[model samples]
Target: MRLRALLAERLVSRGLGETRDTRPQASRLPVLVPVGPQEDPVEAEADMRRRLHAVPAGTDLVLRTSGSSTGTGRLVAVSARSLLASARATHARLGAAGRWLLALPAHHVAGLQVLVRSVLAGTAPLVVDTSTGFRVPALADTLHRALRGRDPVYLSLVPTQLVRALQDEEATRALRQVDALLLGGAAASTALLSRARAAGIPVVTTYGASETAGGCVYDGLPLDGVEVALDAEDRVLLRGPVLASGYVGAEPGGGACDVGQDTRYHDVSLAGGTGQGIARQEGGTPLWRPGSRLPVTLRPGFHLLPTALPGELPAKGGTGTVRVLATPDRGRLEEGRLVVLGRADGLINTGGVKVDPGDVEDALTGIEGVAEACVVGVPDQEWGTVVAAAVVLQPGAALDGAAVRRCARELLEGSHAPKCVEVLDSLPLRGPGKVDRRAVQLLLSRS
Candidate 1:
């Protein structure tokens, strides 16, 4: 409620339950409630009015998460305390509380948190017109206005947006002026990170989902009062004040409720892979020996899992860190810090061998002519699922499917190479401009 007062013009509320939504039902948690600039003008204004004025006090907020690797979305009941806690940790970690440029969609956590961070920082975030979707000129203009303010400015962007920002001189110039740029939403490529650093943009890679109230980990370090751990399976686990209260049950005919105890959770872990630094007992308990294990190295093309040592857990309403329930990601421990890998669900099983699509995509994107690439598993009678890819090439560059596959073979395992490749003008995107893997698979199927 205090956050509402801070952001007078920006309304925080649940999605309007529009029929044509792209995210799965369970994954639609209202983390940072967006003002739906993409919606019909009349409808968007009406929804904003309802959230701004009609919602009663003591009314709970119901938000859905973007379904994890399992493809099932969960509805969560998040409190103002948790949302604020998440924002406070981020602001503290960055060591600066200033204006944030809201470039992401309000409907998703990354975008909504920009506004939330602004509220906690007591600063007004300059919002860009994402109604036409994220564009270079729009982002540049917003960044310029945000920088004009007295307070330092920050921006949160998905990897896709950053990629676009790097293409244009004006956008790149404006982006470089921000105090800090929080990059998350999806795993950023090494090349992308290098480019950002080269451009002198202060980029902080973040790791967290809607469940943890945005990103609990900044630059692979857990935010203050936040706890990051690994499960027996090497999956990442998060616990802290930033954690959401837990999920809510679906409505009778299919919808989410604002309040419910039927689905309160303690911890959740995603399926994780093995790592070099991991030492497990016979019965499967991880033993941590930081910096004493294998060189703390990660494979070039393959995704690695991050391991963790146990940390202090806080009591309810107490002034300590929360506990990890579970997460869908995999990562490893580097010295004392947490290192995240790609999601376990992103792994593809072909011919009884596990292959990471992320690795394949990494290989594809690294190719000279490829601007972006998304690799997915398509149903195959022979191999259970065969690797397929959708790629977007840079302007004036010509790349055939054979060249794409050839590039993957050079960087990835033969099995990891795409069995089929589809060249497109652009990759399909979903929530907050993240690549839509499901939609990419659909494109592969159609071809």
Candidate 2:
């Protein structure tokens, strides 16, 4: 609390309130300890004095976060310029920027980007306090307030919040008022997306991490100045102005900028205008651009953990259409669009056959009585890791484990079938809308 107060003043004074790193620990501000609301004024001031001395004279804004893929934390020095570049690219893709309802926690990159966008748009974000907890009424109220203004309204949310919002009639109506509701954090199930679209919601699926300064790709296509490609291992690689400078105490490619070729960057333009295309392939996988080799030029973007590439690369000779082969969980690029498969880590291995939990979860959700489902790999002596499912049945609906297993087996391979099903009131969630996969596995383990 004391740290935010001290850092907030320093940032606002420098017009960096929307862009600077606010983590005192990463910044080495040991004096600014966490304080409650009732702390004495004198003590707070003394702490502030120490903090002022600790902060270097012309320090750049550095935000620190744990890598979503690797689970390792690092400090990222983000510049006001980089924030603006990211914001501009998003706005260019979304068409306009106006009043934004800040629903996410202010500490994370997703939440901070809302403020950054507001700053770039010369508007204040209508904040939805999550201290009490995220509720549909709170989101609706904040949206109502932001909509009263003439400027366009935007909202950001995780899948969990969207799910709750869809359940409430008032919240669903409020969502339609916004120009775009950016949905990311976790992959939204097909059932969830279908429900949102059915309700006339302008929900834009976003893909990006903290390294890229929030969502760089809206609905699979990279924003202006952003480029998305695949490495030989099929890992998604991003390059653009929004890319972070690099991790604070790391080597080259260790989450920071390049060491030797800092200034030399590839001038590859977005091959197709507006970065849109279509494709038709001989066998599902889009053929490599004819006679075109992966360029040696330096394109600046962070490498993502996902191993899916754009369906069609810029080929030597090609028309607007191309086709790309897709695996079960790793999505394929098709008709110039990237389809995201669920997390690769979530794949369940049973008896030497790999089963995508999402594929099984999709099947479970499609069942009449199942409201939601989360599948995890449970340790089994015979199969190595058997698939287990935690299911949440709809209100007033009853389902048996055998029925769910039978239905899944019908739709999926026998190895992909769940060995056990634990019906629960609700699946455990770690964040706003992310299912606690680890917790689900633990729950099934104990059961």
Please list the Cα RMSD from the true structure of every candidate, rounded to 1 decimal place: 10.7, 10.1
Best candidate, TM-score: 1
Q: Highest lDDT: give the candidate number.
A: 1
What are the TM-scores, per candidate, against the unseen true structure? Answer: 0.75, 0.71
lDDT of 2 by residue, 1-447 (tens): 333345444444445554455443333332222232334868856754543322222334555453332334344555444566788887888898788888876556677778778776767678896766777898998888888889989878988788778878999998987899999877777888888999999999997765677887789777887665542333345556676555444433443323124322222223345353432222333223321222222222332211123343444454333221111124445554566666545577788898877778888888877778888899998989999999987666767777877888888777888888899877776433467777788889887
Q: Please give, for residues 86-131, the per-residue lDDT of candidate 1 as tens digits.
A: 8878888888788888887766777767767876676667878776
Q: What's the TM for model 2?
A: 0.71
| C-alpha local distance difference test of each model | 0.65, 0.63
Model 1 Cα shift for residue 330 (angstroms): 1.4
lDDT of 2 at 429: 64
Q: Could you tell me how far off, in angstroms, the CA of residue 191 lies in candidate 2 after the best superposition?
A: 0.8
